[model samples]
Target: MAWLDKLKALFNFELNAPLINITKNSGNSNLGKEYVNSGEKIDILFDNLSKEKQEKLKLILKEKVEEGSKLLEEKSFGLLRELINFQRTKGEDKKVLDFFQNLIPKEDFEALESSLYLRRRFQEKRDVSKLKEDIRTRFGDRGKNISNLCTAGYFENFLMPLFNSSKEGFDNIYNVVVSRSPMAIFVHSAMGEDQITRDIKTGLEVSKKYGIKFLHIHGIGDQNIRTIKRCIYENKELFNYYDKEIFENNGIIIVELIL
Candidate 1:
């Protein structure tokens, strides 16, 4: 026990480092492996660490469990299972979960659900003409093209909240409105003038109504652009006034577009 205490003290300094790699035969390697492999069921591993390290690691693990519990409450058990499976397959490491969970917040998960629903609506809505007619009647044709409208699964999930309110269902309205625009007609390269022009046009419309502008800083593929153009051409009424030249000057480079 005295030797174990001495060993713990010797490696105690590594606890706070950004990363600590332990080999199988390193002083505390066996203990580390034991804790990780024990189904997170063993409490003895905590006894080997210094008080400070124990407290820090405990807080981290507790946070992970709490996050898992929250996911379970939301009925996102698949995600919870994925997390556990990842731990089981990769060898249980509290640090990995700690880092990953920190990257994703609860709001992000909820937004993902909203985006999914919006995308599904886009696919299911059959009467393109009626949808465009309805929108033009409400918002007026600010050069929007209906056919080119498509919902961005991930991007919309993240940026929707910044410009719209949840209570008013602004995100849903915005998604519907944007999908029908000519700018939605192409996947503009973030740096390409074509994409920038579309984004600027959309931003202007959004700003005029909501007093907020959404800058599309990312670039997309030519294939996607072609697809959007095809969608727009099919629904001319939705894109009658879309401007093409304005975005060329303002489009950001592709590298700069990632969040």
Candidate 2:
């Protein structure tokens, strides 16, 4: 009750509110978790609202849901989940999804986990050439929800900061990720781990060869660059951030080019 009370009073619409008290436990360590006081207050709030106000609020929220539906097509949701996981892995935006964990249905949670499990099993045994060929033959870039996932972390992190700190990096990211068939980047560090061993010269050469568009580097190992070479790599969960990989001596590694 106290937590929700405090949260309700925080005045979330304001942009410059001091968030210093966000971490505090509402002056009670002994109280049990208050993930929510209950939906009763929410019902009460709705009940107290004037009919006109309620209608306006419903319209506002309905519009948002409609907008979200347009954005979250099946394929986009999958890729979006991956990017969000990657961003969190880099510690970029935290606490963004904490509020929604409980809101999601239990069946949805199970289905998502099950789907990931199945995909991982398939990815582990994937043959990039054959798989790409099959994708070409079967999908041919014309499937309703198929997508291309890429990310050049070396260019984004090392080259961008050193060479064009102002806007090139941001623009490139936006074009490749936000635009270009609506693909996005920012993959697991394991995919881009070679940024350590690679020099700028090599990076430029590879970037130029690969059209400067980074494919989601599944992972790197022994001498394999997964995406450009093969394509079985690693991944984390949608929200849990679990490290799932199949990095054998001959596994995914497009992030690192062997010179």
Candidate 3:
């Protein structure tokens, strides 16, 4: 009976192996082929099976992929924690801490941090009345909805320009909103620089020239926080020099949203 149980577990493990492979080799060139092959094989194997059996396999695959993604995210968080340990005393450390705090369970903190980041980065004083009006009109009274709408507009107008210089501009922005309290979001353009450094430099330059404040929401994922923080801290001089207009305008604030 023990041997049978062990064999059953192994069979279940084999059934879920594709998801582990996908997570481990997400960006590999062969990933597309693997996905295609897996789907095709499943289709072929289930061709004569009952409809319920086919549906079960499909659901299983879906669940595995979702579980694998969660695992990847947890791994990423672990890496970020490791990176934080190395930069114990930097202001970036505080920023990272504040960012996570807002992201964990505090929706209000997330909203406030997001608002302050935008206000500081744009060097534009947020007219709370105007913002409130806009929020009411566009998103009603829900804080998450308001944050999503505002952040989307903010990324499109400010960050998108830095990445795409053509008069026509970028294609579209894709955003993933994580937590509300620390109000975290990730923005990506299909056409922007592959490297984060290049993207930051471009953003910094544009912000400096226009006297705009460039509010960075946070790093891509947990793994990136340390590197992103270190880069920003090390290049403080360059950031300040380019953003002199922001300084002149008194547009520097690292938001600590307490909610």
Judged by lDDT against the true structure, how good is candidate 1?
Answer: 0.38
The TM-scores of all predictions, comma-separated, are 0.23, 0.21, 0.23
Question: Candidates' lDDT values, in order?
Answer: 0.38, 0.34, 0.38
- The per-prediction tally of clashing pairs is 13, 9, 12
lDDT per residue (tens digit) for residues 1-259 in model 2: 3333333443233223322121223234324332222222221134334577446555554564555533244455555666466544633112212322343344433322333332333455643333333443544432111222312223234333533444554445433332232222223335543442232234334455434533223333444343323232222122122223332355444333222
Name the lDDT value of residue 99 in candidate 3. 38
Please report how far candidate 1 places residue 162 from its true position, in Å: 6.6
- Model 3 Cα lDDT, one tens digit per residue, 180-237: 2112223322222234456555544543444434435333233444454455466666
Please state the error at residue 110 of candidate 2 in Å: 33
Rank the models by lDDT, top first. 3, 1, 2
lDDT of 1 by residue, 1-259 (tens): 3433343454443233322222233235645432332332222344555678656665554564555523132224443554465446543223323322333344433333323333344555533344444444544433222222224322333234433345355543444444443223234323344544455456556544653323232233454444444544554553454322223222221211101
